[model samples]
Target: MLSIQNLHKTYGAQVLFDGASLQMTPGERLGLVGRNGHGKSTLFRLVLGEEDADSGIISLPRNYRIGHLAQHLHFTQPTVLEEACLGLPEGEEWDHYKAERILFGLGFVEEDMAKAPSTFSGGFQIRLNLAKVLVSNPNLLLLDEPTNYLDILSIRWITKFLRAWKNELIIISHDWEFMDSVTTHTAAIHRHKIIKLSGGTEKLYAQIAQDEEIHEKTRVNEEKKRKQVEVFISRFRAKASKASSVQSRVKQLEKMGEKEKLSRIANLDFAFHYAPIPAKRLMEVHNLSFHFDPHKPLIHNFNFTIHAGDRIAVIGKNGYGKSTLLNLMAGELNPLHGTVRSHPDLELGYFGQTNIDRLHKGQTVEQEIASANGALNRTAVRTLCGIMMFSGDNAEKKVGVLSGGERSRVLLGKILAAPANLLFLDEPTNHLDMQSIESLVEAIEDFEGAVVIVTHSEMILRAVATRLVLFQHGNAEVFNGGYDYFLEKVGWEEEGKQHR
Candidate 1:
């Protein structure tokens, strides 16, 4: 069990939290949700004693075991197994058993245990980090974005593992479905305050919204009553016989008035226009095969056809060829064997997860859009930027000084400003807030073009995907359904059974 009381933290001028409090008991699973850069991570740091809070008290039971997943990790070992073993406590028997169990759960085979972790891709390294944490088997676990780079199968594994776990857990993740499946309680951070909810994230959010609606209605009713009483007093106060009663009614009205200035919910509206239809066939792939190493083909015998106005979603686990497939479609890579053909007049707009580093350091947001070959006039560009929540002086600030979300918005703005009939997006919702993501969903829905998106976000898939393509074992299999249908056909319930 652990408790955080009267917690307060601030960064320079910005107050992250004030008087925030929370209590956790054994076997409790809590999901922490908030917009990006709102101190969710900072709260974890405060709990772990990795950072000092401005003022607060964090208390845990004596001898309580704690485990946390580090955002950035450095492994000095030569192999994945070695890195995972490093987290094991001393004693040969316990270390060997835990190491083996963790490696197996994380999808590593006996042969892979000997392979250098550095040789693996970043996603694999993240898996290694998770394996390390699992091997420790602490009583309290703090996971931040644990599903970010995991493939569907691995994510399923994690969800199962957590559901079976008896220890207390506080997880922070952007994946809505994952949170709903694993967590029993919700903690939301809003406007420098923390709200604790008794139900899961989705239910809690719904209840909060409902409560706000009820509160607004009550406030309105109270205001109406006050206005009626005021009118009565104004009309009857001049009469000698009714003066005392009118004055008494006015005093009661003043005492019973409601506070009407509750904060309004933030909402965004977005629309996008696509150019006239170009060609029937937007892109074609023939016998496409690629491999980082000769022995292991990431994608092989992949062939597909994309047409105008088609919204295709690529689904797969980590290391499976989702990004590679998008890159091939974008003409960023040559297939090791086979031809990728694009129709003439098929202009493309590509957004990748790693595009944060692609922005020019010296260019301001406005300057970056202006330099894009006159595709958009100043007003149109500014309006697009504003829809992304960048306005006034923020648009004039240098891109280098912008936060991660701001940079993402700038990049997205530039991409939207371009004229393209086909768009290839890789995890485009990574750094976006919920509001911005909804705005993007609206824009994409209105665009008259073909879209190929690779993401693990269930919400994004539900909003945009019309066709599902599953990537497994170096092959692509097409399924004729939307996101929900794909989940049903894939036997998500059966996968949940595997967890038990």
Candidate 2:
């Protein structure tokens, strides 16, 4: 168990947390939720003692063990398994056995155990980091965005593992379903304060909103009563002895009257405008096959046709060719065996998770969007940037100085401004806030183009996708309905029945 008391942290003039306090019990699974840049990660750092808070007291039992899985890490070990097994507690053969079992559960095979983690892809490295944290077997586990780079299957694995975990856990993640599956408590940071609720994450959020609504109603009724009492006293004060009782009642009302402070809810609405309608056939792929190596095929004989105003989602485990499929669709890579055809007038916009690495270091936000599309005027560019939450001086900041979320927003802004009839988005919502994701879903729903999105977010998929393309076991299957229908037909419950 751990407790934080009167915690305060500030960066320059910006206050992150003020008097935030929370208590955790053994085996408690807490889901930490907040908007981006609201110091969720900073709270984790404070608990881990990685950074000194401005003022606070973090208390835990003496000799209590802690494990933290950060967003990024560097491994120097010669093999992935070696790196994952480092720093595990000794003196218990069962602990070693558990470590190996965890590594295997995380998708490391016997052959992969001998290969260096440095040679693995970014997604693989992320899984390796998770394995490292799980092997430590600490009493409390702190996971920050643990599923950001993982695919659906790996996320399911983590969800199941955490559901069965017996120790305390504090997780910060954007995956709502995963949090609901694993956590029984919710801790939210908003406006420099922490709000704790007992329940699953979704239930907690709903309860908070319901409580706020009830508070607002109570406040309204109290104000009305106070006004009525005041009016009665004012109208009757000089009338006579008959109104003397009313005056006394007014004094009693004043004594009991207090205004409730209501928290302000920020409103964010995003809209996209489309040009004149186009033909129904947005893109058509025929017998498309791609291979990074000549002998190993990544996507084999892939064929799909996307029509205008269709929202299609691609789902798969990591390293199962989701990004590669997007690349082929975007014309960034050539198909090895077949042809990808698009409408003559179709303009394409591509958004990849790693697109930030391609940004020019010296380019400002203004320059990047301008360079992406030549005809945008200054005012139009600024308007586009504003929709993505970059305003005024932020538009002048260099791309190199922006945070990960900022960079992602800028890239998405550029994509939005382009005259694209077909959009290919690969993990586009990874670094985005929930508000931003909702805005994006709204934008996609309103856009008059075909969208092929590769993401693991069930919320987004269910909201925007009309069709599901599930990739598993080295093949793709086209399912005719939305994410919910796909889940029902695939029998996902059967896959987790044994574990449950």
Candidate 3:
């Protein structure tokens, strides 16, 4: 029930949208795909009237109500329950159960319902806004990275929640599995155009590739014909008898249309530098116990072992000792009780959200990547920069001027350039798009060493996790099986009852 007609948007030297158009059928679920700065969110703002397009028609009915997860937070109510209930539509304010079901699914406890909204953390505050948007029941729901703040349990809850959605939805997410699971169609922003298709992302991407391939072949054939004409004209020009023929060829060459060669798109393509070792046992954890309070232990008397070629995923609800354990394993934090023993030749590379702050703001992207691995020479450094999609002069961009996504890429480039037998990553997909996350999946799959990550994406977990460090029921424990086995045998405990 929504349509964008011949959109043309630009900002100075950068062209965000050029004659881009998309149509959404009523009750359609669309998964929007594009690079980070390719105008996915800009299109959202254009539809919402927050930003004006240079020239376009974004047509929707007068009664259409749009719901989005607001970045700004201004809670009029003090209690969490009351603040959430504020999302109830007019003449239905008494239906607080709708809000409670959403709040509970979003990880709010019974006790938390009475707590002040201001007392919650920034991430949880964002979730509160999300709950409001979800409960509002708008005609068109636009969610951009709703899973960024969610834990594995909450993500599962939202997945189920959105699958039952009857209204229109346009979601932009790096978690392909989630988007593919819920969406009926896939749409992408490619070459300044919106390509919409039925079925999933794989099908849509294959169609795009086939179209581009045909375009390239046509361009090549036209170039060959033009070259042949030019060569015929040049070779026969000196002969008096061939003068008329050469003139005709010249006329033909002049009439031939010129086609611009398509530049190769930059994509994240690189493998992590693996440092192989003969030893099987990489690290051992003995009676690991850690806590911020003496009365409550988050990880208590936990024991686990890390081996070479291991893919261990630490998973649970947010604030439930996932990242804490990752930090402890990476040696960023010390355990309160127990020993985390490592092999003598253990080499580590870590990608964490907090690590972004450690980057030198004054240094360039190339400088930061090279600093991670001192043995890498200038050529290797530039190659790594190119692998990160920072080509030519963009490699010299100062870290201070980079966006959050760019900074995350620099952090990953550092990890890839270094020699690491063991990797510790926490929410590595937070600042990445679909393409970059797919590249990350390949890098993890191709790496010869071990990897341990904390992520909310079931897609990545199912792909890489051979072992799991599960935090559930107020205890952190290790599960010997993969994510599929865990989901089949031991699903998320304490999740709210399915409302659908």
Candidate 4:
């Protein structure tokens, strides 16, 4: 068992947690959730003794084995198989077999096992890191954003493995569906405190939404009463007969208007505005195939069409050419075999991982949006900025100081500000908060244009995708129905049913 009591932690003037406490028992899995800089990782550091809390006590049994997945991978071992086996006892056949099994489960083949960790892509490197951690067989695991670089298949495999493992875990993942799958408890950091609840993330978020609604209603009613009392006091205070009544009303007004700490939840407000131009056929791919090597192809004989109002989701395991397909259609990548044709009038708004880095650091949010399109007027630019959570003076802040989530919003704002009829978005919700994700879902639902998105986030796929493109071993198939139908067809009916 692990227990944190009367925790108080702060970084300079920023108070992250004050008097926060939590308890986790053996075999319990807890999901830790919060905004980007809200101390989720800090809490992990505190628990691991990498940092010290100003005032607190974290108690655990002696010799409690803990395994933490490192944020970055730097393996000195000669091969992937050797690195994964480093923690296992030497000369033990069972340990060697377990390590091999973990590596294979995470998509490492026999050939990959002999390759250096640097030979893998960033996503595969993350898998290697996870495999290294899992092979250690710790009693408690601290995984931060475990699903960040993983695709659907690897994510499902990891989820299944964690569900059946009898160990304590504290995970931080933005993917709500993944969190709901393995967590036995949910913990959220809000208003400088942690709220721990039994059950999964879905129920916890639902309760938070309901509580916010009730708080808003209560605040509105109090404001109305306070305004009425103030009005009565001002009108009747001058009259001699009503002086006493006015004094009483003044006291009532003071009581009603007394400052109370309102709920600090700030919701994201945004919308996508697209030109009402329609094209029957926006893009077409015919016999498309791409390969780095002449004899082997990552994508082979792929064919698909994009029309206005088509919301297609591209999903598969890591390095399986989901993003390659999007780039091919967007003309970022040239196909070796077939051709991709697009409408002459089609304007593309593409948002990928690198788009955030492409933003100008010297420019403000308003300047960034306005510079993206010369035709955008001051009001239009400000409107776009406001939608991206840069309100009033906030629109003038330099982009260089913005956080990852803030930069993502700015990049999205720039994309939406354009008059593109087709959007190619890769991992649109990667660093966004729940409120921002909700706004994005609404924006996509209301968009009149088409979208080709490559994302691992089940929430976005379920909310925005109307068509599905499932990628497998060097092949692709398009499902005519929605995300649920695709999930059912792909042997995820039970998982999909639980989330639904």
RMSD of each: 3.9, 4.3, 2.2, 4.6
Candidate 4 — which pairs collide?
Answer: none
Model 4: residues >4 Å from true position, as ranges?
A: 89-94, 209-259, 392-394, 487-500
Best-to-worst order by TM-score is 3, 4, 1, 2
Q: What is the lDDT of residue 71 in candidate 1?
A: 57
TM-scores, all models, native as reference: 0.85, 0.85, 0.95, 0.86
**Residue lDDT tens for model 3, 1-500:** 88999999988988888999999998999999988998899889999999999998999988999999998989999899999888888887999999999998998989999999999998999999999999999999999989998988888889999999999999999888899999999999887789999888889999999988888899899999998998898899999999999999988888887877877777888788988777899999899899988787899988999999999999998888888998888788899999899898899999988899999999999999999889989999999899898989999999999988999999999998878899998888887988899999998999999999998899999999999999997888889999999878887777534422
Q: Residues 198-264, candidate 2: write the lDDT tens digits.
A: 8866676777789778888998988888888777887778878747688687778969758667866
lDDT of 1 at 10: 91
Worst 10 residues of 4 by lDDT: 490-499
Query: How far in Å is the alpha carbon of 89 misplaced in model 4?
Result: 6.7
Which residue pairs show collisions in model 2?
none
Candidate 4 vs. true structure, TM-score = 0.86
lDDT, ranked from best to worst: 3, 4, 2, 1
> lDDT scores for all predictions?
0.79, 0.80, 0.90, 0.82
Which candidate has the highest lDDT of all? 3
lDDT tens digits by residue: candidate 1, 1-500 = 88988888998997888888889877889999887877998998888889998888889999888888875769898877778888785465346767866676666668988899888777778788888887777888999888776766667677888988788899988776678788888888875778877777767778767877898898888888989898999899889999899989988987995766577544445554465655899889988889888876777877789988999999876666788888877877888898889887878878886566778989989888666548678898888667666778777889989887788777777776777788888887776665567678887888889888888777678888999778764567777779888777674433555468
Give candidate 2 regions above 4 Å deviation: 70-78, 93-97, 207-268, 370-376, 487-500
In candidate 3, position 450 carries an lDDT of 93
